[model samples]
Target: MIWLLLLLSAILGAIAFVAGRRLATRRAVGQSAHSRPGYHGAYAMIWALAPALLVVIVLLVFGGPVKNTMMESGSPAAVSALEPFEREAFLADAERVAAGAEPLQIWEGELAPALRSEGARAHRIESTISGAGVLAVVLLGLLGGLIALSRLRPNLRARNRVEGWIFGLLFACAAVAIITTIGIIASLAWDSFRFFQAVPIAEFLFGTQWSPQIAIRADQVGSSGAFGAVPLFAGTFLIMLIAMAVAAPIGLMSAIYLSEYAGSLTRAVVKPVLEVLAGVPTVVYGFFAALTVGPTLRVAFNDLGALLAGGPLDGIGQYLMLVQNQMALTAGGVMGIMLIPFVSSLSDDILNAVPQSLRDGSYAMGATQSETIARVLMPAALPGVAGALLLAVSRAIGETMIVTMAAGLAANLTLNPLDTVTTVTVQIVTLLTGDQEFDSAKTLSAFGLGLTLFAATLVLNIVAQRIVKAYREQYD
Candidate 1:
């Protein structure tokens, strides 16, 4: 009913606005208001909508807290022991009673009379208050719109006021999105801070070991695992380096080919095909990395060396063995393949956006395509390309599934691509994957890892944005 009323008010207000505009005359009206008749109508429309919307928004923000407070104030012991299912059942029975309907039969059979009666009373009050609030907002919206319309005059600047209001609304809405992000970051930071209090910050940061195991029982264990995070960082960086090595060249080259060399038909077919890679599930990629790519790489390394020395492969086999299993090479290589389209597609857009006039000038100078591209286009598009690479790096750094599946869990401190290492993300996932007590250092450690990851990403993003801005200035 409230929604229906709001709709009616809007329709009526619009009609009245149109009527006023049609009646407006240049000379007949004694004095013109701030804006013309049409703007006045819009002003009325805004006035009509804003109040009710504000009321609804305020109610939504407070509704949960209000309900919780009411429930808490009533008596904690009453509902504290009730299981989730029982509490829900109790609430439903109360609602029916509050509505003046006969109590549910099950309530009479299972619950005590006093408890059921109290619940029913609470439900009735909450429902009545909510219903009345909605009705009031709807009526007020119509009343506000009507009053604003009557006050609308040729001298009034309704259009300016409305535009100001529109901009304010937009700013407010944007602020909400920013505030939400800040809120999430704050929550994670707080959790991480608590974990830091339990575990020394220096050990978490600098210790090469990372064992986030907690004793489950007093009688069961001699010592729990350490929470040194060094290995996780080493593993993540190793894999990222590998991924960047592969993705940077392949993705950038693909972008170059598409933007500068590929024919339209080839581009039409190939671009979409490449993007399909992105749509593939990360889990699928994980399995492919662990099962398919890892083994294949091991075999390929051996074969290449053997091929190079078929008759007398003296040191070939030895070299091949060095690059095998749980190494940075395999994870990086696979991740690069996954990230190729991300880098290429973004790079292509930036490259394509480089002004056509610059290309024309280069061509007029008798410069070859390669020369023009290398000297002029690349310089111009460097910022955008740089931004794309940074974004790709961000993606690589945060990647979880592939590393979790292929990168060995053992956080080896070795920097060699062939040695297995773990990442901060993988450690985080492992730490909190199971049921955990909130206060335990093991679970809280996940938050610390999260805060680190968040900080890294934030820094990278800021750098990327700055680079992109500089690139934009080159054209201007």
Candidate 2:
């Protein structure tokens, strides 16, 4: 019904716009107007639609509450005698009975006939109110259109007014974005404060242990939880390092080749093919890591370990024997594959944006293509490239699905890529999964992890911005 009202309002506004244009055109047949016919039409349309829409929105928002109040006031003495909560439930049943649906809870006695009577009365009142609201909207819209049409003259500044409105709208959108970011940060900080009160901030930030389990009863085994987050941070850092190590060179090289070396046809074909990797869901990459890469790595490492077990390098072999299917190496390598398109696409755009004159000048100086690209192009595009890599690192650090699937959730404080490990994001998910009491340290710990992650990402962004600004200034 609301959508129908809006549609009718739009049609009425359009008709008014056409009528306003005709009026302005007839007036202009005698003398030149200050603005175009379209501007006069738009001015009329805005006047006609804006107030009518605003009124309709208000009516729609408040209509239900008003209807409920009227129904409760008209409700029978028996119905009103019920408790407040029970009265609400009884009204719900009455509404159902009025609508001809079977009442789920309310059945039997004088309640049934009384509810039916009240429900029918409420429905009739709602219909009457709705009809009046629509009539009021139409009248207001017509009044606004008539006023705007009468005011339209040779000197009216409709175009300027319209442009100002548009500018204000755009500014409002930007303000909304800024406000939303502040809201998110404020929420995280508040919950993190609550969490810190329960667990020491020093222990969370600096302790090496990563256990988060808090037993409800002292008799429970392994319930003495440790909240040291160092291991999770270390694991996160190690995986991000491995992912970047794989992504940076390959993605950058691919971007360079696509932009500088590949022919038009090859660039068109190869760029999209590489970008297709980006569209492939992370869960698919997770599956690839878990089912294919993880197993392959484990078997290869185990075989290599067995082959070297009798040799002088026995200790290294023994270490290799402990390599598992799900480990940091598997997750990081797969995650790197997922990040390639982000790096390649951003780097390609940045490299392409470099002034053609710069490359021409470098070539004119008797520098070879390789030398020109290595020294001039790379330096000029370094800032954008740095920004892209920073984004990728942030992405890598926050990834949960690939880490959860490819890397086992053992919060081991080790640097070895072959051993199972977990990231802060993975731990955060684990800590909050399923039914949880928010007051418990176990659940609140997720907020702590999230706040820490947000802080770390913010710091990285700030540092990257400074570096990019420096390089960009030098190049410019």
Candidate 3:
């Protein structure tokens, strides 16, 4: 019904545009027209569509409450007699029945008849509302179009009016984005403040343990749960460092090769194939990490450890024997594979943007290709490359799905890549999963972690921007 109303409104607007254009053409046939025929047509079209669209918006906003009121007032005795718990469900069932779906709940005797009658009532009420809405849209569209047409003139400035409407629309879009960001910040800050009240900021930031559960009673097994978040912070940093270690050199080298060394044919073939990594879903990477990479590393390490257990490297062998399928190394390696495209694509573009004259000058100076690239091209493109790497770091920090699936959720503070660890994002997801009370420190902790993550990313972005600004100044 809503779509039908929108289509009818559009048709009305189209007809108005045609009528308005013709009238403008007729009126200005002998005089210099102030506005073009197209402008006049658009003016009438806006007028015709505005009122009809407004009707749809109002109906959407208020229709639910109005329909519920009507249903409640006309509800049969059987519905009125239902307990509150069952009443809402039964009412929903009646609505479903009215729409030609079976009632989800069973009813007996007089109640069954009452349910049928209620369904019919619902159908009739819906019909009335839909019919009235359609009529309102058609009438309003025609009335507004007539008003617009009656006022069309050679000097009316229809284009100015339409352009003003466009400016207002663009301003509204900007304001909505600004408002949404402010709202999110405010919500996170408020919830984080609440969490901090329950858990000391120092302990959360510096202490090493991280158990979020709290018991309802003092005698419960885990009443005073540990909340030190140092382990989570350490784990997050370790994984990010390991990921960057794998990604940075490889990604940058690929970008350099793709831009400076690869031929056109090679670039076209290889760049897309490399970028295909970016398109592979992170969940798929998580599966690859967990099912393939993790097990492969564990088995190889365990077998090697067993072979070396009685040798001179026995201590190291014992440690290797403890290597697990779910470890920081597995998660970090997979995440690095995921970040390759981001680094390579951005760095490639930046490297390409460096002046071709610089390369020409280096060659004229008798510098070899390798030296020219190392001494000139790389230095010129450093800021952008740095920015690209920072953005990749931010990407690493925010990743949850791959971390959750690949890295086992144990907030271990140890830095050994073979050990299981979890990041801030994985812990945030763990804390907030399923039914939870916002008042509990456990649940509120998710907001705290979220705020921390946001701040870290925001800082990284600022740094990236500053680096890019420096490069721009150097070049400009």
Candidate 4:
């Protein structure tokens, strides 16, 4: 029915457009016109379509609630007498039956007859509402089209008015994005506040432990759930640092070589191949880390450890032999591999964007390609390169699948990349994995972790932006 109304609205708008253009042509037969006939046609189309669309939107938003109210008002006594949850279930079943679907659950206490009565009433109510909605659409479209036609004249600035509408539409899209971001932050903060009420902020922020397993029942044996997030933070940073260490130099150098030295054929082939890494799924990297890299590192280190045992570097040997399959290093390395394309692509673009005049000046000064890149081009592109690196860092911090599959879920606080560690994102997923009540600290703590992660990332971005702005000011 909604789709049908939309088609009718489009047809009516087309008719209005044709009528408006014809009238404008007649009016401008001997006189100058402010706007073209096409503009007048578009103006009429907007009037016809906008009003009808507004009506349809109102129906879509309020139609369900109004129908539900009608059902509740006419609900059988048996349904009203049920508890709140049960009453909602009964109404849902009646709605299902109204749609010719069987009730999901059996009912008692004369509810069966009540269900049929309410169902039939619901069907009739929906039919009436849909019929009224169609009528309203047609009436509104006709009225708006008539008013638009009557207002049409050689002096009407229809083009400007249409442009105003388009500008308003663009502004509305931007406003929606801003509003959505604010809403997400508000929800995270509110839930995080509730969690902080249950767990002390000082402990959560400063304490070293992060065991967040709260007891389900009062009498249950449980750990009381330590919400200290230091371990998670440490794990997150350790992995990110390792990833950046691997990705930054290699990715940057690859960008430099490709941008400054590679021939067009080589650049065309190599750049695409490197970027294909970005398209590879993170899970595949996780599998590679777990199955190939992790065991290889462990075995290689263990063999070296065996050779060093009872020797001068016995302690180092033991530590090396203790390397595990699921470690921060494995996840970080694979994540770095995954991040190569982002760094390379962004840096390549930024470097290429540097004015060729800079390169020519360096060459005129007898500077070689390496010297030119190191001194002139790099400094100019630093702001964009920094931004790209920060973007990659944010990506690394938010990653979950790679960490979950490669790094074990042990919230260890140590800095050793070879040890099993878990990030805040991994813990957030673990905390909210199964069926659980939301009010508990255990569940709410996911929001806390999320909020903290958000704040950290936000701060990182602000710092990066400042750095970019400060450096960019000089160049600008």
Candidate 5:
């Protein structure tokens, strides 16, 4: 259905484009005041597309909730958790009555008519929006085209005005992406606020414990759920540190090799191969970390005397030992591997983007490639490299699957990399993955963690940008 709608919209836009052009051509040859044939075409295209697109937006926003409410309100269980045969008979009778036939079927046919009527009404409403939109576009296009054509005289200028409108439209389109990001952040903040209301902000921010199991029955026994976020935060930081430790050097080295050393042919092959890493699924990485890397590390660590000869390594081992099996080191290692391509690609771009003249000037001073790169290129690219590192750190912090699968679920409020720990992202996923009361502190705790994560990332980004600006000014 969505594809069909998109196809129709594209077709309508093309038609509007052609129609607008034809109308413009028919007017005085060089006459246009506010816009040209192309501008009019685009204006018409927007009009043609807006209505159907709005319909889609409205439908998506309300459709699921409305449908769920409708289905729930009609209590199927109350009627009977009926036997299959009985349900079939009921449906059959309903269909007969709905068709206005004699009551030969088991279910009432009146329900069928009602459903059909509602479906028809929805279709009519959608069709009306589409039809009106298309008509409005055609009319507006014709009027605008005529006015533009009339104003386009030998001495009159239309191109500048047309360009201004074009720029405005392009700017608005670009702003949509930024606006969407802001909207998402706002939503996260709102949810986090709700979470803080349920759990004391202090406990969430500074508490050392981290469990989130609620009783399923009145007599079920378990530890009281802990809302302290320290463990998750510690786990996340541990993993992030490990990941950055791995990714940073590898990526920076790769970037240096690519920008300063690799031949064009080598770059052509190597760059794409490196990029393929980014496309690999996080789930694939998770499985690799959990099933392969985690066990391998355990065995290796045990051999190296990190674990006792006969003891099973359990939960966050850094500062606390609550659950066994999570090793922050493993999760962090895999996460770093996952982040390598992200850092390498970005660093490569910045390295390459460093002005050629800087290198030339160094070479002119009889500096070798290595020395020129070290003294000039590295300094020049430092700002961009710092930005890339910050970006990598942000990504590592928010990463979910590998840490969740390999890092262990137990939050350990410690900084040791060897200890198994959970992160805010991992906790959020664990907390909300299944059925839960929305009002519960456990659920709200996820929001609190999310809010903290947001603030941390925001601060990091600001700091990175400021550092980059300062670096750039130094070079200038």
Candidate 6:
């Protein structure tokens, strides 16, 4: 029914548009017009559509609540005497029965007959209200169109009015984005504050241990949860460091080759191939890390350990035998592979954006192609490159699936790439998974981790902006 109403409204809007254009044409024939026929038509269409759409929205928003209110008012005395939760559940079940869906068998009261009668009444009321709403929309739309047509004189600045509306809409969209970011930060901070009340901020930040298992019952063992997040932070940084180590040099080198040295055909082919890595799902990378890279590294390292044990490093070799499938190296190396496209694409664009005149001047100064690229173009694009690296680091920090699958869930503080570790994001996911009470410190700690991650990323962005600004000013 709503869709049918929308179809009719669209037809009316089209008719109003044509009528408005004809009216504008008549006015132009008689006198000089302020706006074109098309502008007048657009103005009429806006008048015809906006009010009717708003009425439909309002009716849809209020319709269910109003119908529910009617049901409650007409409900049987026995149904009304039930608890609030029970009554709500009974009404929901009654609604399902009325709609011929599976009936909930929870309600066993003597109010079945009353409920059936109320459901019938509710259905009639809903249909009547919907029909009235649709009629109001159509009538109001026609009225708006007629009024707009009446106002369509040679002097009416319909174009300016329409443009003003469009500008307002654009501003509203921008405001929504800003407001949403602010809302997210505010929510995280509020919950983080609640978490801090349960766990001291100092301990969470500086303590070495990180065990977030909380016991619900007093008799439960191993419930002594620790909220120290230092290990998670350490693991996050270790993996990020390793990822950047792999990504930065390789990505920058690839960018340099593609932007400066590679032939046109080579650049065209290779750039897209590099970017395809970015399009591949992170879960696929996680699978590769866990199933392929992790095992490969373990075997390689184990062999190296055995060789060393036969040599002078027997003590270190014994420890190296403990190296397992899932470790920081496995996760970081794969994540770096995942991040190559981000660095390469952004760096390639930045390097290419450098003026050709700079390269020409370098050549004039008798610099070789390699020397000019290394000393001139690269230095010029350093700020942008730095920003790209920072973004990649941020990406690495927030990654959960790859780390969870390949880096193992142990929140070890060690910097060893061979050691199993976990990140803040992984821990956040772990804490929030499964059925849990939000009021507990364990669940609330996810918000704290979120807030910390937000702050770290915010800091990275601020620093990157400053660096970019400084370098940009130098080049300008």
Give the top-scoring candidate (TM-score): 3
Q: Count the backbone clashes (under 3 Å) in each candidate.
A: 10, 0, 0, 0, 20, 0
Instruction: Write model 3 residue lDDT over 349-463, tens digit each, in one string.
Output: 9999998999999999999999999999999999989999998999999888888988899989899888899999998888888988889888998999999999999999888
**Residues 252-329, model 2: lDDT tens digits:** 999999989999999989999999999999999999999999999999999999988979999989888878899999
The residue-by-residue lDDT of candidate 1 on 392-472, one tens digit each, is 999999998888777778878878876677788888888878777888887899999999999899999899888877766
Q: How high is the lDDT of residue 460 in model 3?
A: 92
Please list the C-alpha lDDT of all candidates, in the order they appear: 0.78, 0.88, 0.91, 0.91, 0.71, 0.89
lDDT against true structure, model 4: 0.91
Question: How well does candidate 3 match the true structure in TM-score terms?
Answer: 0.94
User: Global lDDT for candidate 6?
Assistant: 0.89
In angstroms, how far off is 428's CA in candidate 5? 0.4
- Candidate order by decreasing TM-score: 3, 6, 4, 2, 1, 5
Mark the 10 consecutive residues where model 4 has the least summed lDDT. Answer: 214-223
- Which of the numbered candidates is closest to the native, going by highest lDDT? 4
RMSD of 4: 2.9
Worst 10-residue lDDT window, candidate 1: 19-28
Per-model root-mean-square deviation over C-alphas? 5.1, 3.2, 2.1, 2.9, 6.9, 2.7
Residue pairs with backbone overlap in model 6: none
Backbone clashes in model 3, listed as residue pairs? none
lDDT, model 4, position 240: 96
